[model samples]
Target: MRCSSWIRVAVASALLVFTASAASATLVVPEPSDGIEVLVSSSCRDRLDVSLRIDEKSSPGELVFTLSITGPGSTRGDLRGFFLNLADESLLDGLSISGPFVTGSQLAANAVIGISTGYTAKSHRHAGGSSNPFDLGIELGTPGISKDDLQTVTFTLSHATRALGLADVSGQTFGVHAMSVGKGRCRTGSCKLTGVIPVVPEPGTALLMGLGLAGLALPGRRRA
Candidate 1:
């Protein structure tokens, strides 16, 4: 009878731990389309690299997502001038890109491509003095993302401008254009941007799981 009780407790505890570990994360971009679009002085030369961080409470190493970029057929420009910054600041930046994914005829009907990067900025070209707002479209794959994980992305404009030499615009303000998908279509709207989200375990849930595990272990010890 004692052995059976111990086994039951152990099994229950293991189940609780497994469930807790499998808890889902959430990602939210609480803004309307028409996102943000900031106009930096022509003096800004460095291109911006973007990356997204999911679940700040969880190590960035644990969160992964596939990123792709596409553009309207009317959009014709060389994206090689920009790159993505994927360093320790993964939570700060979205994902980095190097070289143009679309060119000439490839820019039609919107195309998508994948991107990845590590620490430090990879050498790339800086936009010239020309004040052109390049329109780059992004798409994120939602296979493993959970509904509870906190998600935020950052864009780091690294490069020197003729006005500001070797400037790192890590915290500089920029405009963002917000957009959303509904009924299998995308729409743009004016969005009020805010700060990033923090992720952490629920205190009550953590406590309960801990106690359950302890109870199971105690029964096993007594049987021994």
Candidate 2:
């Protein structure tokens, strides 16, 4: 088959796959693939600019997550708490998490995984004055991740009975609280970062689109 003809076919296939994936409620980031990156899109989304990367681990029903700041070149902050909601509330009982700086846990109306060295109601209080609750909350210790850095904590989430999959955690609500954001006189005391699932074409989709465009340009280039 001609290169241009094959490129056309590839573009069509990519479009079909992209449409089908979008129709589903859950976005699957399969094992070994780059995890879904959820960015902070709250009032402080730009200022704090944090992100949560969720990936499926090798172990059955296990998922690994990393949280980090991603803007302003530099900043200073400590993650006070991390909050999330499971597909179902009952999953909370079997859920297990392990990470650095994780100290305690809390389950109120929703699951709150406390991750603080000195856990306190005052510290866990949601920054930005929002009362949104979560199915799980992780209280982190002091000296959290800072600018241009992915540090402080990397944790795994697993269940007991359920072999958790994309349906169990994908497209779920999540939030993070940070203290002392910014640096060199630009420091703000604290800010709340909430999850914003981005809608982007898969890499394959983008490559297909690029090929289709290139194919269209090829004949013109030859004629020139």
Candidate 3:
């Protein structure tokens, strides 16, 4: 086989491995049978909408997440605290968060907020009242992601011991607390939201998979 053929094979092999390791997922409401509950009242439910997306980072043991909390056209509120569970409970000790900022995708940028983490969910008022004891707590500061102003938060999570992937967080429970719920029947106070993360296939991964398979199929030239 020619040197170029070997190079092509090696490159393709790496691409396959890299793409396979990188995964993505989104959060969804868990079913009652799952023993998870949303503490937000029925009236307040419409006042707050929380959505989170997770993607594998280029570096091993790291993942990036975008969390958006919004309300219906008439409803509005603020995100106060967020909570979640790790599939591997042991990862909690080594878990670290970075780059937590209000995403700049919106036209008018929101205020710069602070991010705080607690090992036990009970440390937060919202998560403490929940049925599930979340493993991690993320507390945001005042003027938190304003639902009326359309704001979102983005951050990265890294583990010290293991290489992180979509599987690490997929199907895990997540809880969110929003305050000042208004614009409807909801009283002016707080609401708790809980859900599970679901894995989603990334288009780029599919493309890389195809390219990798093609490269591996390439015919190698033989020396005469």
Predicted model with the maximum lDDT: 2
- Return the candidate ranking by lDDT, descending: 2, 3, 1
Candidate 1 per-residue C-alpha lDDT over 1-224 given as tens digits, one digit per residue, 9 for 90 to 100 = 00000000011111221111232322222222111221211101112212222221122222222111122222111122222222222223332322222111111111112212211111111111112221222222222223211123332222121111111222222122122311122222111111111112244543455555443221111110
Q: Of models 1 and 2, which has the larger lDDT?
A: 2
Q: Give each model a TM-score.
A: 0.18, 0.62, 0.53
Q: How large is the C-alpha RMSD of every model relative to the true structure?
A: 21.8, 12.9, 17.6
Reference-based lDDT, residue 9, model 1: 8
| Candidate 3 segments whose C-alpha is farther than 4 A from its true place | 1-42, 57-60, 100-123, 126-129, 143-150, 184-187, 199-224
Q: Of the candidates shown, which would achieve the greatest TM-score relative to the real structure?
A: 2
Q: Model 3, 1-224: lDDT tens per residue?
A: 00000010011112211111123212222211211112222234344555555656445567776656544565665666666666677676677766644221101111112123422223344351345355666655444334333246666777777777767765566666666666755536556655545333354554455545543331132111
- Candidate 2: C-alpha lDDT: 0.53
